[model samples]
Target: MNFFKIKTSWSNAEFILIKLCMASAYILVGSYFHDFFAEYYSILIGIFIITAIWFVYQWLKKMKTHSDLPY
Candidate 1:
């Protein structure tokens, strides 16, 4: 029952890049359609921030675990 035991094959850079692309797409679409996105802009931004923070946290945790391993 380990919460942080999940593993990913993608490198940190790739994961971050994908998340950035998604966030950028949302912003771009919102900018293009102000009427539709104005109300949800804050929510979208919040999601992006949360996801970025999660990714960083996971990466840091992974790094810490790896650093502690005997080579």
Candidate 2:
């Protein structure tokens, strides 16, 4: 399944707000996981950081989107 093909009814700000909410929820759950399995903390943090960077990149790219239609 392609993720980019999925359409959302939310505007950019709403979408960013939802993303922040989801990121915080993941951090909360991830902290619990880290507490129980401390050995994997580095890997878990690495993945989280990478995913956060990817999200920011996608958001920036989306914001920079432009139309080439004649004015």
Write down the RMSD of candidate 2 (Cα, Å).
6.4
**Cα lDDT of model 2 overall?**
0.85
lDDT tens digits by residue: candidate 1, 1-71: 88799876887877898899999998898678999777887999999999999999999999999999999
Candidate 2 clashing pairs? Answer: none
- Candidate 2, 1-71: lDDT as tens digits: 99999986867877898899999999999877866878887987899999999999998787667443345
TM-score attained by model 2: 0.46
Off by over 4 Å in 1: 1-34
Predicted candidate 1, C-alpha RMSD: 7.9
For model 2, what is the error of residue 21's alpha carbon versus the real structure, in angstroms, after optimal superposition? 11
Estimate the TM-score of every prediction: 0.51, 0.46
Best by TM-score: 1
Q: Rate the local accuracy (lDDT) of all candidates.
A: 0.92, 0.85
Clashes of each: 0, 0
